[model samples]
Target: MSDTTTVGPDTAGIGRTRTPTPFRRLLAVETRKLFDTRSGKIMTAVMVVLTVGAIAGRGLYAGPRLEVLIGTAGLSLGTLLPVLGILTVTGEWSHRTALTTFTLEPRRGRVLAAKCLPPLIAAVAASAFAILVAVPVTAAVSAVRHVPADWDLTPVALLGWTAANVLVVAMGLALGMLLLNAPAAIVICLSAPALWSAVARIGSVGETLAGWLDLNTTAGPLMEGHMTGGDVARLAASVSFWIVVPLATGTARVIRKEIG
Candidate 1:
């Protein structure tokens, strides 16, 4: 027998490093996490229920005008998507999973990117789904009530509606990232519009500032597809202040903060 034993193939590769996860995989994981948690699942369910109820209510009582149906569904989705975004970012901290997440990924910016992408996609999907559901319901209501089924939604209006919902979702993500605490993030996200509305009522100067800085006001024209050049300018300014600034600040903070 030989005095020395030969090294095995498995042992020879022991020092080899594993590959980092691809961005696509990261996005998929983040998307799945949105629905995997108990709270995520519950919130999603509530959103769906509210959307269906709103559409159905419109069909039954109010005229199932396509615009009204879209607006109602959009409102429900807008209300809930932010909560979903907040929980998505904060849940890692709340559940003490940040340590593991950072350990595995080691790049906080990529993690944040992963977290942000899902909500935007979800918002677009939810908006489309609402439109799809409304079509059949509107037809049924029109037939029963002998009203014309107005399928007169223009491309611009549809695009604007989707864009408005996406902006709201982005706002929620920005707020969530900025606060990093679920309750505080959620409260601020919900109350900021109302607070700004109060501020806007103070004076002409306040109104002018709000017109440019308040997303609730600036984004309203988008839903109606009636944005003028001024409306577009105001929307841009408001999004820059609310979404861009906070996201930049939050990304820096998250990158620097030590994971416990």
Candidate 2:
């Protein structure tokens, strides 16, 4: 005798056409997951608190120029966004839920894309929040310091601040996809710049490499609202190395890695 099981009439594909889960739905789920975990909640709270602190510190330190306020908020976010990005991808793997996730959505590429998009969205949102918060903070600072505030924000400034946040977070996502271990991904994402800086101190060759490939140096001009063609070229080169390469490799790994 052969063992057999009966499928439900509605679920057996006999009476209905099954639609693939929508990508938008996947995005929604992924976005919700960002705030659903305890760690995620804690990280978010920390980010909020840090941004306020950074904005206040900058206002008090140098007066509340719009550009400086946005930059300070972005720098504060950059410090923690990597961890959030890392967990976005690695959380499932680290928590042993990859099997379930892959089972539901067999297309690994979509899953990876979904994981990547939310961090980018968060980066954009963070930048917007920074800008909004800067306005009130600027007014408050002017009152406290009795100096007029500079509200000389430009489109380039907005793009630059957002881009910087996106860069750090994207790097984190890439590392998480490559490593699939939250701790490992977070460590590398945070420490690689320092490691690179150490290497850059070795000699003139290192300096040249840093000028071209160091993300901080290349992205600095864009953030400061004065990027030239050479700066653009260097930024592209550095982004290709730092963000694109690992992201490609990591997607491959995610697709190939067996979920156990």
The most accurate candidate by TM-score is: 1
The estimated TM-scores of all candidates read 0.92, 0.91
lDDT (CA) per prediction: 0.88, 0.86
Root-mean-square deviation (CA) per prediction: 2.8, 4.2
Q: How accurate is candidate 1 locally (lDDT)?
A: 0.88
List clashing residue pairs in candidate 1. none
Please, what are the lDDT tens digits per residue for candidate 1 over residues 102-132?
9999988899999999989988988888888
Q: Model 1 misses residue 16 by how many Å? A: 4.8
Off by over 4 Å in 1: 1-17
Best by lDDT: 1
In candidate 2, which residue ranges exceed 4 Å CA deviation?
A: 1-17
